[model samples]
Target: GVDQLETYFGAYLPQFFYAMLAPLTLFVYVCTINVTSAVILLICVPLIPVSIAAVQTWAKKLLSKYWDQYTALGDTFLENLQGLTTLKIYQADEYKNSQMNEESEKFRKITMKVLTMQLNSISIMDFVAYGGAALGLIVSVLQFRSGHIDMAGCLLIILLSADFFIPMRQLGSFFHIAMNGMAASDKIFHFLDMKESEKGNQEFPDNHNISFRNVQFAYEAQRPILKNINVECPMGSFTAIVGESGCGKSTFAGILTKKNENFGGSITIGGVRLSDISEKSLMENVTYISHQSYMFKGTIRDNLRMSDPDAADDKMWEVLRSVKLDGYIKEQGGLDMKLNEQASNLSGGQRQRLALARALMRDNSVYIFDEATSNIDVESEDDIMAEVHNLARTKTVILISHRLANVVKADNIYVFSDGYVAECGKHEALLEKNGIYASLWNTQCEMENI
Candidate 1:
């Protein structure tokens, strides 16, 4: 969008001035030779803009649709390209290829329509400009024949009649370029006009206890994800939220990180409203680590430093050692080893350990481990959980996971079912009740034994 606007302004401004000033100058010259010829030229110049305006009315809708399709096609292509390996694994490459081809065809049709509109508009402007010039020359010849103007004056009018319409005709050509920029600007303006989420200026309180009271959330109005969720993670407590898939375990934790703010009820941190806390203070106080934590394309030291930019080499190694990743880093060329995109070169366990190491480097008051141990080997998972337990001794740790075993040591376990908290207690207490939590735990135990 920026590129289109730049191209339009950079090239259109000079042409716009020429179109406005040059045609008036020529009109004055023509009037000196013959008033009637000057009047005819003046009248015809406006017809070019009339045709351009007519084209613009339709081109606006066409170009807007063209940009929409262009953006959609680009998004689809990038998504498919990034997931190409997964597609090939599932033998779905041909399907995705055909889907992309359909998107490309739609883009091609819109582009051709834009071109056709440009061509038709230009043709109309050409007819108005040249036909008007021809009309002026005809009048000049008539005045010459009637002896109202001399032969020199008539010949000059004939030569310069076309010049009168040339500037306006060129402007008609630039109108199409400007139209594209205008369409892009409309989208940008619409985005800028959207209402921002309200935030308060209060700083995070020193006491880090977190609580949710009757909190409810939904991505859509009808389908609620978290309903009447009331949980608490007091300072220096190991609070775990365990649930089956789609049971809102992650959604419960997501509220603390401000992933989604549109919810019912209220959440408070140290008796201060969650919404009252400023974004900077909230971010500085919380660290969220998920199973698929993003790793940038940089050295191991570089990725770790994102959590603590000024962290020294000794501190980095200490954090890495805590996650049992120090030996792996030392063998793989130390902290300076370059990681590929998403750190694809590292195994799943190694990546999670590295992510854990990075999180440990930050001195946050609250830590959220959202399925952080999933898909990793037993050894790496144990090492990561050990660090998490250690962190819980000081920081307020909220663990969200579907795995029943990992939450066995939690100070309090909140088991979510559907969108509500169905059970809440310690691991043994919930199991003794023989409720949803016990059912899930027993099923998992049976699966592992099998």
Candidate 2:
């Protein structure tokens, strides 16, 4: 260790030593003239830590602000990417870009402020370290003339005093870097301190019969998305939820799946209120496929394996065939064909099919399709809807769709509007009522040229 240290010093110290020839010459002049260097040593010692401490204090403040800005930037980026389609449809790309630039500029300004503070602190520290030492040496030399110290002692003190400041001053500057690290730690600790979702009662009956009794829920405080949503999805029966936009269709599905647990009233699965049931057990019986189908970045087979890791390749092929994606996959190099992030490399219909295949692999007792056919092409939509219709025969399916025609064959349909169930019946029965469901259905059918 000693040899290594000396070797490192030998490599870099000479360059620093050469750069300080003027100061070294001054020291040589003072010492040779029988001057003392005690005052120089004293000034260098205290100023090292004090100046560093000041810089460190400022660094802590700056880095804390930086972490906040970084987190905000990440959140904005995610939101922008998720809403990219809407932005493009509305031609608001420039608007979002400007917003992003605004946050970026704020980040840049904070970064510059930190850099400026560091530079100013370092400049002041360097002056205190070098200038004060120089002045102290001048005073010590004058004192030596008054017989305070001998020539040899003066030479040693002059040489050693400058050398002493080198390490202490550098170490002092490191205090600022340490403070920045501490500031980052503050954010990490805050995240760590946040309360995790609660673990509830674990007992669940083998049979999965979902029932919602006066279930009330809201994402925001006291503003209910779902208001007294009383419904029952009996075992071995399909239940379709028909609703217009913002009618709490998705919210109801979310509650049934136990994705969002903060709700009023009771939701029971197999006689066990979901709030009392453990998250793991609830997930085991329920599988939800939403409107925006997400695909993991891997081969098609790899993504299929996510739902059932022990599933054989042939089983996956069978499931793919069931969703009518097998022919396409086979033509496009089979399951070995890689899916990019969110399946961006594939068409919208293809991604939807892949998501369906994954869900089918789970083969859970309950299936929730929240506008699952929204993105597919007409031909693909027909094929996928057919597959969904078939799945509903055996599994307790909750189909939430705006396309009324798809739910025509459903055993029961509950129409929702303004966060309430405005109408409830089979598709034909609801159509006969000529209410909101009838209007929406007529409008959608006209648009589809059906």
Candidate 3:
């Protein structure tokens, strides 16, 4: 898109004026010398655009297909590259390679079709331009022989005949590029014209209590993910949402953050409707951290500053100490120490701890930890949860975890099954009920014992 836009603005637009005016100026000059030849050249100049118009009907479809195949090839390559290790581990690399090769071949075939169409159009334009010039030259010779014009006039006509067609020929060339630019512009305009999500004018309410009443959500009409779900995560409480995978646990958190806004019921923050709160105000009061929280390739200080841009060095150290990462950072050359992409230079536990520390820098009223402690060492998980529990002392903390052990201390644990809340209460109460939560807890306990 950038390349096409640059070519359209930088080269095509300027050349467009020259192509239109240069031919007219030269045609008038030829007319002054030989009217017959000038008229013939003018007649032939239109054939160039006529041929372009003809090619355009076919070129538009071809270019669109070319772009589609190009995008598909790129996506396939990236997906394969990201999953290369897994493919090799499973001995499926050969199958993936074959799939990628098929996609590449399709792209190559479409690319050749685009080039062949361009060549054929250029050939037609060349034939019209030179044929018209040749015809004009013959007319000039015939006029000279009849003594209707002088030899000098005939030579001038011959010399300038090609000039008449040159501008139009250059235009024919630019027409193909213009077609490509227009194709890209079509996609860009479609995206730009799409309706944006509605914005609310209401400010964030002072009360941070959250309540979901009869919420229902589905990606498709036939497949519901959350059905008439009602839950509460009041301020100054620790609320945990736990369920088996595919039971809409994450979708519950997603609704509060406005990730999925097309729900049937009302979600309110304090007393204000969630949709009524402006996005800026909602974000200012809520912090969501997940297991795969992204870590940029920068210094430790640089990453922390994302949460609180003006946080001082002392404050950074304080948060790091809260996550028990301060000693590790100091040992690794302090906050200025550089991290590799995705913080791959650090161990998995270190990365999570650092992420938690960065999140701690923010003074948001609500903190949502969506499986934030997953895939980490027990020590790191315990340390992170300790800080999370501490935060629950005065803030609304919602924890979503797959591990049944993690939410045992939560003041309120909502157990989801299928879509609705199957069970919700303190850990001991949930276990005593012998329902979904109890079943999940017993299963995990049995696995741990094994």
Candidate 4:
């Protein structure tokens, strides 16, 4: 759309220039030059249009590089704003400013180069248009002296010549504007060309059993995050996954949510391959809540309603009560109280509980908590964990946590290490084995005593 406006102006320049110049120039010289002299002067008018059209075509091709730089400038500004808080905390404001200034200066320099090219083209076009007319007038006068034409006829020829080239000169300027607009259009077309992922053909099952068969995955291809991970989550039982930091704990949860898809082997939900299930259908059955719960700016009711848009006010309060958050909601002035950006108005624990309530409202068949209890206070954590355990009775629950205590009550526990499942069994069974799981358990136990 922006490009079209630029093209319109570029295409119209020639017409505008000639209309203004022809009448004025002809009016000035009509009473002065003889017929033969005027004919010679009129020859200069064609030069204006021809010169502008040719110059503009050449200049338009050169302006595209500048347009790309402008897009880059916008992209950088977006990145800087997103990371402004990090920059302030690290005292790196100066460093970021320097980078921003450098990009801006480069962008300014490129724009100036485009402008310089345009100015030079215009100067040359003007010279050809008016200079040729003047030279033509000199020759016509010499011809008039030789009795070749009458005075009024000379004036008419000159006036007509000026009329011809004025439009062409203005057109040359318009070409530059049109080309800049086209350069912007090219970027928009490129963005629009991105392909969406194709949906699979297999039908999804109503039941909610999830299993991974020799699954392997990595954010980076060479650095596998989960290697040969295999777990079977029964339709209505709690499965807990515990691991050290960077040991593919969250990656496992992400896989269950289909947020991380680069993997080897297969993951099936209710005997249907995860890849085969459409994203929307898969999302309908599963919900993953992480520690950092994103709360958009709105009332508490607004956030809850996002889970099930048509949920009634009573249903919202009921879900909040289930998550043990209804009392706090009432204390905070009920659901009408607004939350600021990212829910800054709520404390860390309140935000997590709200997230839990939001998840409960959805009533997804499968619920995965990835470090959901790691940040909140112990009291809040326990209340939420109790709620989770209760939910486990009717829905499949997958808990991935760094804290060993959080998953102790899980029906089955899997200990992960170096992208592989190092141990899997009941918590006591793993303790008896005295392997990786036992070692990790002991380490945490010793830390707690200290």
Candidate lDDT (C-alpha), each: 0.90, 0.77, 0.90, 0.80
Listed per candidate, the RMSD to the true structure in angstroms reads: 1.6, 7.1, 1.6, 5.5
Residue-level lDDT of model 3, residues 54-137, one tens digit each, is 999999989988888888999999999999999999999999999999999999899899999999999999999999999989
Candidate 1: tens digits of C-alpha lDDT, residues 256-375: 888887899989999999999998999888999999999999999999999999999999999999988889889989999999999999999999999989988888998999999998
**Model 4 Cα RMSD, Å?**
5.5
Error of 3 at 90 (Å): 1.1
Give the clashing residue pairs of candidate 2, or none.
none
Q: Candidate 4 — which residues are off by over 4 angstroms?
A: 1-86, 121-180, 201-203
lDDT score, candidate 4, position 346: 85
Pairs that collide in candidate 1 are none
Model 1 RMSD vs true structure? 1.6
Instruction: Estimate the TM-score for candidate 2.
Output: 0.79
Worst 10 residues of 2 by lDDT: 1-10
Candidate 1 lDDT at 447 equals 94
Where is model 4 poorest over a 10-residue stretch in terms of lDDT? 30-39
How far out, in Å, is residue 206 in model 4? 1.2
Error of 3 at 7 (Å): 1.6
Best-to-worst lDDT order: 3, 1, 4, 2
Runs of candidate 2 with Cα error greater than 4 angstroms are 1-48, 55-57, 67-105, 135-143, 201-204, 432-434
